[model samples]
Every structure is written in structure tokens, then in C-alpha cells.
Target: MKRILVPTDFSAHAENALKVAAQVAKKNNSEIILLHMLELPHQMNDAITSGASIPETMLFMKKANETLDEISNRNYLDGIEITEIVKMDKPIHGITQVSKEYEIDLIVMGSHGASGIEELLIGSNTEKVVRNSEIPVLVIKKENPDFSASEIVFASDLSEEAYLPFEKLLKFAKLFDSKLHLVTICTPNSFKPTHEIEKITKSFISKFDFSNLETHIYNDTNIENGIINFSNSINADVISMCTHGRTGFAHFFNGSISEGLVNHAIKPVLTFKV
Candidate 1:
């Protein structure tokens, strides 16, 4: 049976992710694992000792349990087993640890599109989990629930790591009966039509029996703009890419393509660790 791991923070976005995971599990006949990682601030314990009355931690756990109970009682997941895991640690660390321990096949989480100071300081937990975990991470943009992913757009540089997640992506495409669109952007300076690219694309497609697979190559100056524009042109339901989680000087000026796509894309952006 397929095991789906969903990490929740009890936010509306996380709850939406849980709902999506349930739909996916019901469709695939898989079990759902509802995980919540509680990373209490450093002052949490101190506040308690200082009589600040920080019961919010307990409240979070209680709400998580209640939500899990609600999901379990749903008629859609009648036979599918539902498990709840509550951990006190950083969200990304907890997610990665649970994914390894449980051998999770897929991870579903929500992204709030963090930006500016918040993003610069802590970075994105979703991005961190995507970079650290070996499993497939599906990030749902909370604004676009009505958008069912009928077409999946994959942005790749044709790197070795890019191909590693194809197995999982193909499985997901088959499960959803969605069309797969593989795209690679070539800049003016990087413009070179090589046989290797063709071979790689063909070999990848040959492995899948999908009837609705399309490959495209775009010549553009900005990679991010190319991806976003192509996705918009095709009206893709979802976009998938591999993130390296680069930071510091390299990241400050160049910025992260995956984070930029997630922040700008109107559709769901599913990221897999390379």
C-alpha cells in the first residue's frame, strides 16, 4: 500500500493539504499519515516558568488530534488506516526524520509563499524539506484549491539529479491520469541543440506508457520568466522542479528559481529533492 505523509501546522493551508492528501489516498487506495511538528519558540518554556501561561502548544497538539479524528471518520477513507504523529522539533527536521523512519512514499505540505524578511531569515521550510528529503514533496499553493492538476509541467536543466525523480513523477502522473509536459529552457549564451538532450528526453519518455506526454524546448533570456510564461500559456495545473536550496552570496543576488516559481506561480508547485 502507498503511504502518504502529510505534515500539518493546523493552518488553513495545512488543513487544505490534508484534504488534498485524503482525496489522493482515497483515489489511490493508500493510507494517510497526519504529521504535525511542533517547534516551540525558544522562549516557550521560559514563558511557562515565568507564568506567561503558554497553553498554545498543548492546544496545537489537541487540535491536530481532533483534525486527524475528523479525517479518519470521513466516509472516503473507510478502510484506509490513518495515523497521527506529533513531534516537538523544527518542522523540516521532523518531516525529514519521519519520512525516513516511516519510509514515506510521498509528502504533501502547504506553502504560504513566504517573502522579504521572513523568507530571508528562516528561509522556507518547504524548500528546506524539499532539498533534504529523498521522497517526493508536493507543495500546494493555498490560493488555488479549485485548480485540479490536469497537466504537470516539469522544469529541468537535464542534470542527473533531474532524472532521479522521474519515477515518482511518472507514478503520480499515472495515478492522476494527468498529462506530463517536460520543458527545458535554453539561454542565448547556453543555446546548443545537442543529441544528448534528445536522447535523454526520448529515453525518459520511453519508460512511461503515458499517452499524453509532450516535450518542449524554449529559447529565452530569463529562465524563471520562461517557465512561468510557458506554464501560463499551457494552463498547467501544476509545476514540478528540483531545488538545491542554495543560500548566501550565491543566493542573495541570483535568488532561488524554485522559490521564485513557487512564489509567483498561480498553480501548485511540487518540488522533489535532487
Candidate 2:
């Protein structure tokens, strides 16, 4: 982890994720890029008289900078390399642009009250980034003053697309020296026998050299709940999965299990794009 990009709305939850990112930075000696965006209404530029929007824009920009400075100066982030960026573009675009500009290794974001909010990922800025970013995104839900990837519950369908992200997951797990709780969720709609699952799992992991690994077959009605239930059963620190970054009609029909998990699961979710 060389640099972490954290997009903030200055909400309590954003701070929650920021604190966790601090712990991560401390662990890896990584730099923290705190990004705040001020998107002036597009209509203002066209409808308002010339220079009419300048005052409000500058005022908001100044206030955002002050706030960013305050956060960077917080004692919790002490001794950490911090960079503050305030962009004028939309939230998702700003995040994408900044991540590339800074060569960020990871993005840590605070979940915006995922409880009972079934509204699809397409509508939310955070979810939009989750759906598009090529790098790993860590969604933090609550305060974890001492966050650690001591154990990660990684659920997979063991499909071919999973291999790529699993490799990224392995690199991360090894970096943190975390135990891997690899699970295959078997639902009624897509059930498979334990012997077959074991056989596939054996073959799937044959290409890797991770020693701190555990494999299991879990049963539940859905993938999201099964992963959550299994994670709860072991009290794992993180829930890991792969997202296909589905969008438009495909996302509408198939819906992303990883995105759904981010919405409902209280535990931190680590997602990588397949």
C-alpha cells in the first residue's frame, strides 16, 4: 500500500473511514490523499450573470480547504504524510481522476448508512466509484480505532473471473499476514455437493502458495447473507469479495453480490474489480 485515496463529505462516517485509513497508513508507511470535492451547480454558470457564481465558488472553496487542513492536522493522523485535494468536478469523476493522478494503491471510503437502503449502487457516488475503480476499495462502516486485517472472510463462486481478483486478495492477505477464510456459498438456486466443491477448491488453490488458508462450504439462501453469516460465525475482521463492475442492464438484472454486501454488511468490505 503506497498511497490511499479517501473521498470525504466531512460526515461522521467519512471520519470513521479516515481513522481506519490512518491505521492502514501507519502499518504500511503509506501516504494519505484526502480528497474533498465542491461541485458548483452547472446551471449557475449559464443562468447567473457573468462572475455572479465567483463569490459562492470561492467561499465554498476556501471553507473546504480550511476543513481539509483541519482534518490533516488532526492528532490521529500525526506523523503521516498527508495531501489534501479539493476538486471542482463531480464526486465520482473527481475521485477517479485523483486516484490516477496520485497513483493510489487503495481507496478507503466510509459507508453512507448502508442499513436498509436497497437503492441500487448506480445512484450513489461511492457505489459508482466502487463499480468502476480498477483498484481495491475498502468500505469502512464504523469506527475501528484499531483496524487490522487479522482475518478476512473471502467468499467466491470459484468462477474463472474470480482467479484474477483472488490473486490480488492473496497479495493483500499476505501483506497483512492475515488468515484467509475462503468459502464457497451454496444456495438453493445454485447448489453443489461438498465433494465437488472440495475438489474444485483444491484445484483452484493449487496455483497459489498461500499457507495461511482455510476452505469451507457454507449454505444459505443467498450469496450476500451466506458470506455475512459465515463472517459473523467466525467474527472475522474483514469481508472480501470480487465485483465485476457491472453497470447498466447487466447490473440491473444480475445485481452485484459484492455491492449488496457493501450495502448491508456492517463489517468492513474489501472489494476488487474483476
> For this target, which candidate reaches the highest TM-score against the unseen true structure?
2
Clashes of each: 0, 0
lDDT of 1 by residue, 53-118 (tens): 567767766876787677668674577778888787787788888888888988887766544212
The 10-residue segment of model 1 with minimum total lDDT is: 246-255
Q: Global lDDT for candidate 1? A: 0.70
Spell out the clash pairs found in candidate 2: none
Instruction: Estimate the TM-score of every prediction.
Output: 0.78, 0.92
Supply the global lDDT for candidate 2: 0.82
